[model samples]
Target: MKRFLLLACLSGLLSLGCAAQPAATNVPEAIRVEVTGKKNGRPLLLVPGYVAPGEVWREIAAELGRRYQCHVVTLAGTGGMAPLTVAPGASYYATYARALAAYVQQHHLQKPVLVAHQTGGMMALRAATDFPELFGGLILLEALPAPFAVHNPRLTPDSLKLPAREQLLSRLVSMAQGTFLQQQQMFISTWATDTLQQRRLLGWAAQADRTTWANIVYESMTTDLRPALPRLQVPVLLLGIWVAGKAVKPDLTHAQVQPLFERQLAGAGAGGEVRLHDTAREFIMLDDPRWTLTNIEQYLAAHPSKR
Candidate 1:
């Protein structure tokens, strides 16, 4: 499934290049932008999840770009064709948030709206709390307002202990065998229903630095964004997935996740909305980009700019 998708995206890219056309207009190095629409608008910034790049929002961004200038941020040390390092605790989140705020100020973006996914949603919460004046609202996708209970066997404390540097290096070398393909499969099975989109996402993951993958995994396990949620002053939207049946992992129940969001929204004293999509899981955006985009559009419309 993934292989077929990869081939299709590659073919599409080649076709576009051959036809002297572009699929999407990507900013060269500017990770921030001014909001330009039919009417002046607030900037929309997208923050991606662990092991994923800003391109994960490509489809949605292109659609939204018609109405709102969109800026997709790929965290400096995450999945990119660059050297990587382990980001210390909340420092990465804080630093990126500050950088984004500074960019907004520099470009004079009107109270940018942050659209974040997975761990990126946590970072957005931290940013909104720390710099309320720099943001307008937040759209959180598949994020828990509190720390996820460490119950998944694959994400246990013992399982997350950082591998020794040398051991990690060895593992990197071994990853050359079939690790890349395995990573590709893991991403597809986890986030995508369509084989083409799965392959496109896998290609991005394959290009990521080994250290980035390890560090992201380590940070994801240790960092908890619950404390920052109560401090936010901006409006928020929490989009949670509702599994059809009892999850194989009993600890990851929808009931357990709901209270965390409700508590945070109540604490924020900000307009908040929660929607449970029963058919979707952790990667709701990837599974149904149109639905995600529609929800966001309606939210923004309902909360039109005061200016």
Candidate 2:
């Protein structure tokens, strides 16, 4: 799938001489934005999932770079970006969302299409909700409306609060202060499925600030975006991957999964579209890049934004 997607993207590209090549760009340090691709092409912002670096979009960016200006963002507390220190009582994700909007405005990107994954998708959704005029479209890769909403339908912030807060916080604090190996072990065991990917994610997580990481997770868990969905005006494409074999309900069928995602996203605005991909979990990009990229291309084509 990886090779196919790479070739497919490369084959579709017009000759480089046909269009002006992209130039490197320098962005402010408040939010980590790695700019690439044709300066004249339509802008596309890539946001990675939690604990993931902008590197997660490396292959996708390489392909999309041929046709669009790609802005790969690494939010504070994730990957190599340093934790964002905010005033007391401020939410980290909320602060990051505002900073991201500022980055878009500062760059003068006119209605850039936003492609985000997992937690990053949530952040982008919140930003778009708060600043509806800033974005042209949204593509959410395997994004959940609420974390663990699939496992428990009745889940809410009040019901989902983390138990043993002090103990968990202490553990995260120790992991932050501990050797790289300790932190890496915690990261890998919890998230990564591939060995090399595990190591790469670990390297970044080790550099992340513990308080920032813990706070974001807590915030993400408590955040419920269902209410804000109907308020959005931009087009949204949700690509969901359903692997029944890996599911807790191994016998789960698409019939069941589709409606669950729909229910979770029922409050989404009229512009929202939900698609289900039959593939494995954890590494959506690596496992089926072709399907992922093809859907993304279709979504972009449907949206048809111009810089």
Candidate 3:
């Protein structure tokens, strides 16, 4: 989820904002990749959310790395990687999606299992849709094919072009470093229950390229993949969080959530399933590592690659 419901709220609390077209610039961007574990193990590509470093998957990747070769990706424009200068009217989403496809091809991953969260999930979905055969399976962590439209069928990418989110990013980006960090701390506090993890989140947010981050948020909110879902060829698994804990009146039930997930999966010719965690928040892996890993393991086992 963009900013953990700040950008993609199934609750419809935060309306996504639009951005002004970016000017052209000359810069070559590279995604930072960290490969580890058994050289012969099945490739597990891990992608983190907006402003997060690939290390965001450190804890879970470590666990999975014991059995799989994990290629953790920190996309260009964040985590110390130089930001990609998006041309006017161009899409950051497209840039990232293409980058992902190229990475898989360049690395010869042999139908890797892809695990992506939030904006990264959006990117992976686009890439998977465009190059389905490159991946063994798709696992989206708290991501929707059309995040903003999940709660509202009426919303279009054009409709979410509001000012609040974009303005907020502007304000945050303009703030002094100390103040910006404080704002980040406040922004992400609700995303994770762990204070330590919260600090790590803050650290990444601080290191992020403010300009690229703004473009990413705008692009993510404005893009919807539902129409392209029909092109999906690989098996998919959506792991969504219902709430941090307890059943609140507003929090949706499986009966309610399942249908939406099914709708998202309906377009996938290969089909898929959803696993909602009632007790975890946006950072489900950090909140419940065991649950996240176990679910992923099960999915991988059930959908072994057919190379």
Candidate 4:
């Protein structure tokens, strides 16, 4: 059960990396996109992880909006947004990847920078891999190409298991709503330091569609992006948190985390840079706004949209 429990650790935790082509396909209403800031600024997309609402990026987007046109997204089924089930033979991650591609095309974004967190980062990675030309740059927060690699670097994509997601799904299906929320809040508290921020994340969890969340988590955990790292066409900046509230492995330190991230970067060729923070939790923006904002600003400066 080590694999099961460890994989679920971040279920409590926490997406991107787009190109702009033309073609207007209506993005389903389930995935809400809220665009604002700089009438003529560079297109910037911020995607949140797990069951988080678009609100998670509010502060960061507000600041980034000063120079970039910010398009904040609230994915289907979470954040009080409508939930949707993928049709047979389709997965949420793949579907969203296609939708995001359409979004960039429909909106006419020219190689927008994709900034995603956690699950959202995983989804964006899928899109980047499937459509490498969709983005000019990617900035990922508390995201890893594959969680298993952090625990066991020897675990290659070929060795990864796409476990039956039913065990975890059944647990959520049977748990009482109140109890479910309470347990989720506890896990979230460990990952997000601020009580108010914890409450906000829990608020989204409470309203989230459990089935959809489990499905996304299952698809995400089962995915292995390490193999695709070398194929990523855009420059990537990964901002990860090693300290703050890491409950899975209480003794987890920056040293252990840094090497793993560096290992992933080693596979990414010259287009990757990783910066791991020790003081901030998984919810870096909420726990350490200044640090989060500063790193993003620098990444954008280095990978300007003009490219």
RMSD of each candidate relative to the true structure:
10.2, 10.6, 5.3, 4.4
Over 242-272, each residue of candidate 2 has an lDDT whose tens digit, in order, gives 6623424567776767777777777767567
Ranking by lDDT: 3, 4, 2, 1
C-alpha local distance difference test of each model: 0.59, 0.67, 0.74, 0.72
Q: How much is 15 displaced in model 2, in angstroms?
A: 56
Q: Over the stretch 165-264, how does candidate 1's per-residue lDDT look in tens digits?
A: 3444345435563555664564355455577767766676666555545444434445555545555667789886645223334445667656645654
- So what's the TM-score on candidate 1? 0.72
TM-score of each: 0.72, 0.81, 0.85, 0.87
The residue pairs found clashing in candidate 3 are 1-118
Q: Which stretches of candidate 1 lie over 4 Å from their true place?
A: 1-39, 77-90, 150-174, 244-247, 250-257, 260-266, 269-271
Candidate 2 positional error at 76, Å: 2.1
Model 2 lDDT vs. the true structure? 0.67
Q: How well is each residue in 1-307 modelled by candidate 4, as lDDT tens digits?
A: 0122233334443300234342333477546899988988988888888778789999998888888899998888877677776664357776776777788877788988888888888777777776777777788887777765666767764575444566656666677887777666556544577888878877877788887777776665666778778878777888887764345577777787777787766676337888977776677778877888899889888877665
lDDT of 3 by residue, 170-238 (tens): 654576877656555554645777888888877788788877776666666677788888777787899
Lowest lDDT 10-mer window, candidate 2? 1-10
Candidate 3 Cα outliers beyond 4 Å, as residue runs: 1-28, 164-172, 244-254
